[model samples]
Target: MKETAEAYLGRPVSKAVITVPAYFNDAQRQATKDAGRIAGLDVLRIINEPTAASLSYGMDRKEGLVAVFDLGGGTFDISILEISGGVFEVKATNGDTFLGGEDFDNALLQHLVDEFRKEQGIDLTKDRLALQRLREAAEKAKCELSSTSQTDINIPFITADATGAKHLSFTLTRSKFETLVNPLVERTRQPCKDCLRDAGISAKDITEVILVGGMSRMPKVQEVVQEIFGRQPSKNVNPDECVAMGAAIQGGVLRGDVKDILLLDVTPLSLGIETLGGVFTRLINRNTTIPTKKSQVFSTAADGQTQVGIKVLQGEREMAADNKLLGQFDLVGIPPAPRGMPQIEVTFDIDANGIVHVGAKDKATNKEQAITIQSSGGLSDSDIDRMVREAEQYAGKDKERKALIEARNDADTTMYSVERSLNEHKEKLPSDVVEAVQAAIADLKGSLEKDNLEEIREKISAASRHHSRLARPCLGKRAAAARLLLGGRPEEPRKRSMRRRSRGTYAESNSQVVVRVRCIKLFGPWEGQDHEIGVRHSCCLIAVTGIQSCTAVSIWAGVLH
Candidate 1:
């Protein structure tokens, strides 16, 4: 996939921001990053899937609370976010990693298997190949029912018995399909409720609800979402592509292609250490924004304690044994004191990457020990280093290819912009200038065909020069012609307090006419100041607004009393 992207972009792509399910733990996120590194990409950030969907919907530009309901093939996640001034901050997130459209398919498959077994007096589940076919048919029927009221599922020669070849066939109605998956749909409700409660907001506070992932397309799922949020789900974005689009948007922000938007994701589970009596002590609660730190001081469980053990755990469970143990370390050399006499400060710190660091300090001695909880289920450092070394061996060839692609892209952009400008202002521009720009555009196009980086760059420079020279007196003739047609004689420009404001006056048979013009060039040498053009007599006041280019003017005139 990396090679394919590089081929299509005409460049060597290296950096990326990957999206993962919001419920993924530290180990899962690390595994995803390791996969990217193995693919020769420098993973910049790991964002949540639902958060990325919101970005694709441009929720960052809106101000309000939003709920993202994401139901994919094998997982369901609900996240509540507050968006204000291009900042998307996730307040809470909840999901079932084992629940999704796949479960729905399985439900339908089981129904089919039961029906066939009852009819044929033989359980199709015993046949592996037949069961596989049934599973596929069930999935297809489920998808078909999403758009239609009913669908027919038929697999010829699916199985055989003493009665010769047998065929499996059935018609599944949408209502029946809904019935089969209603239980699975109900599972999503509790998560939404949990997330809303965690965010400290009610359903009424949510301004918009966005549905993402392929499973969100089901009518039953949409109905459930509407019932939960008290409004129709937003259909502005494609359910299947929004997550990927959001990731691309994030990538643009990191590359400086986009600006102003900020994303603040949260840790899915709590981080803490074990305390007295095997109890779990939470320092950082679940759904808390990351890159944060919390500390609490505890006394020794035993008298004359000289050392304390810090067992880092993650979860919502109350017992240390029930939670996931991330790492453990002992902080020794503590002053021997009576129980409850010494203060042991245990601090839990989580960085932006969602990695946790636990530190313990003795208040009396100021002696501290810390441990960084490493990701367990991913490649080791030695494996990553070997993969990186293998990739670097081809760096020279990749560099040359990247240089050529960049040069060609720059040349193409320059040619298009210059040609578009010339075409737009052709009538106002001198014929010679128009012809010169067209020639430069043609040269640039020809150089692109040769794929010569140096030649293409030279052509781009030449085209830019012609494009820059297009700012010469293009609008003066038109302004003068309009003034003459209005039956007024051009008068000498009169100085005004504002350098950009100028007035012209002409005499008609019955009334003295005045014309005022202010031209503010948005770009080039005349960017900051405005130019005044004279106009002939008219018994009206003309106001021009949004003066973007000297070559184009929009005038709104009103009759004077």
Candidate 2:
């Protein structure tokens, strides 16, 4: 089975969805998924056999009831659905988890042995060889009865005791076959009626019904179905090919080809856990949609209890042992305290593909603990790399946003400091000095408020140099006042020495050198509203401070405005 499954999956496939019987165990499910992985196929999803069949039959219909009575060799499932606008919505589903068409053929084989015993007094009840041959004959007749009005089953076989061989043949008419298979067909009648009742509708509401699976090919099965639904079933989709085709459609959806339709599947069973005093705490009910999140809060019942144990189950049973265990958890370090002191909140998140994640938090400390849900949907290395790259791009955007915010804040701070200083020094400073300073601060703050971060930064930077200009005039006035009040001789103002030095072959790293040059320019008379220039050297860097910029005109001490 593994090799066959591998070979089938290895052929050039874009995507695929594997289907298995609903009653399969965990080990069987794992083997099938592993086999698909080994074949290098991108298995998109796994669907239940019966549900897949319904999709294949109802994908084309805009609205109808498709009764998928699947009786395969080893498994039986009956799913009734209502389709509308390309949505295959399930109305109700029921099944004899152990019964199938093979079981029906086996029952007929037993009947044959009973008749042979009464006619000849030769019992072959303990004969595996005889039973195996009878099975083959029953299967052949069951297939033939579907088309012909009547079919005969003839078997020429050897005796089990090696005494002799005998011929056992019987004719089965369609009417008589209905009488024989009435019991098998009757089991579905109540389930269908219950389905209609639970779905809150009558058979009259269903426009057209569909039949899926090979067992529905029987003429007697068709009669019972028509009598039950009060209408003829649809034959637009083939029974045998429906399931695979439906799986293919789902595979296309996973690959993003068929996106207009959505399949909102439900959990197969109730999910809950046993709580204190042996009471069951229900987390999710049956038929609940997948990819959901639910939470439960708990607290310590007694002092010194550092942990709370959680045992999860997936069945309607009240007892934990009676239900199937999905998983368990422990809320560690719950803290030592009085009864009902530490609060522990637990969250359960189940994803669309039937995977679950658990989280716990301590309410007292507000600390969180998260359980990593094991996933079948793990990304490849390249996908991880791409995700990291996208994350880095977002980080860059965040940094840029912060930088812009900081720039505006700095502009605001600078304007605040400058405005306060201008108001306090208005008495000593000139009117133009105070007004110019106030105007610059106003423009800078207004720009910052309007999200003009770059312009704010530049204006603030320009005003930063104006700080010295403001301080120079204010200090000059204070100095003149102090000298006059003290009746003291004023010291000579410092001057900057200017010089031109040529490049040399030698360079000094530690040596200190200072040079001073003095240029004295005396104006003869005022020419063209200009004055002569006078320069002096100083020991430090010198800056020309004024409220207006002065330019040289006709080699005279220029125009100022």
TM-score of each: 0.66, 0.58
Pairs that clash in candidate 2: 495-537, 495-538, 496-537, 496-538, 497-537, 497-538
535, model 1: CA deviation in Å? 84
What clash pairs does model 1 have? none
lDDT of 1 at 553: 30
Task: Write the residue-wise lDDT of candidate 1 on 20-125 in tens digits.
Answer: 9888887777787888888889999889999999898874476789899999998899999888889989999999989988899899999999998887787988
RMSD of 1: 23.0
Which candidate ranks first by TM-score, i.e. highest? 1
Tens-place lDDT digits, model 2, residues 16-70: 5888664443234445554555444455676667668777766665566656666
Off by over 4 Å in 1: 1-4, 364-366, 375-379, 386-561
Q: What is the lDDT of residue 138 in candidate 2?
A: 78
Would you give me the overall lDDT of model 1? Answer: 0.77
